[model samples]
Target: MTTYNLARYPERLAVVQLGPGSEVPSWAESSSVFSITATSTETSIICASRSVPAKTRHHRPYTAFAVVPDEGSADFDIASGVTGVLVALLTPLADAGVSVFALSTFGTDWILVHESDADRAEEAWRRSGHTVAPATPA
Candidate 1:
């Protein structure tokens, strides 16, 4: 089984959607937890701090948790057609009645659990035999 170290972000986040031509807000660029996905039709931006303007369509007050391997260890390497990795992680959270908003990149996965459920989510992962640790400095 793969071991995961989870890091909880301190600030609140917002998921904002804007038209393709709209520029990303300047505040988003400097956010501690910022992610933007753009396409021809629309753009989605997840910002760690600050509120979106009233005109922007957005969901707010979400919390982010990063699931990474221990420091100095190799990444999980799930890019090579691997399976059951995410399912294993998420099943416990679901069983604990925690809903997740997940994002994946080549190296690690980020799960956004509602702020109210953060504690329960962490407890669920722990009970499932995963090691949860504070994020080490990069």
Candidate 2:
């Protein structure tokens, strides 16, 4: 098993896009924060993180994450590879002067970035041996 040092992991940022079109929503504000919790059909609670107002004229705010699954979790083996993948990706971004916010979960890691930073971050990741495809229309 590979050992990880959190401090050694590189940071990245990602933003959540709401609404449609390549253009950002004019009314979408990120300063406002709210969260939703729902009951799963399996009788479990699914809690969502609070989303802050995320839109700016030129840049959108995104949440960053470094996801690590719970100890002994069934998916830990696969999820563990994320750290190495992320670390490889982050080095170049830092060199390019990108700021990042990172978050982690039992299932996956999330990297939030300002909308302005997204394109560049993706480019850097691609150069660093990761395949980050553009987000398709939702």
Candidate 3:
């Protein structure tokens, strides 16, 4: 198993579900670290919890983990690019019964779990032989 370096993001996030073809809300830009995914069925947004309006149909307070990889003399998990990284990452979480909301972008793959499960998420990854650490601001 390729070990992944996951950086835990500071801001708690939200996953907002909107109808298909819905315009990306400007509020989605509330955070630099967010993912907007549009599919045939719906437009799902993963953004800073504070950015989403209280009335939106959304799930909040998820803790985000970025597969930052490539620690240089460190490790490699960069890009939305990783072969089987998700399987490696998710399997343990699944075994641990942690529900995850995953997002992949040009930059990287994100794994979000309810804030209540943050510690368990970290433990799951660590126990799976991966490294989990606080994200360093870019």
Those runs of model 2 whose alpha carbons end farther than 4 Å from true positions after fitting are: 1-60, 63-83, 135-138
lDDT of 3 by residue, 17-82 (tens): 999989988887555467667889999887888878989999999888888757453223354344
The digit string of per-residue lDDT tens for model 2 on 37-135 reads: 223321211112233243422223343323333465544356344436456546767977888755444445556655467678767665655555433
Q: After superposition, how far is residue 35 of candidate 1 from its true place, in Å?
A: 0.6
- As a whole number from 0 to 100, the lDDT of residue 112 in candidate 3 is 88
- TM-score of each candidate? 0.81, 0.44, 0.85
Score each candidate by Cα lDDT: 0.76, 0.42, 0.83
Worst 10 residues of 2 by lDDT: 40-49
lDDT, candidate 1, residue 49? 44
How large is the C-alpha RMSD of every model relative to the true structure? 2.4, 12.0, 3.0
lDDT of candidate 3 at residue 14, scale 0 to 100: 88
Count clashing pairs, candidate 2.
27
Cα error, residue 96 of model 2, in Å, equals: 1.2
Q: Give me the candidate number with maximum lDDT.
A: 3
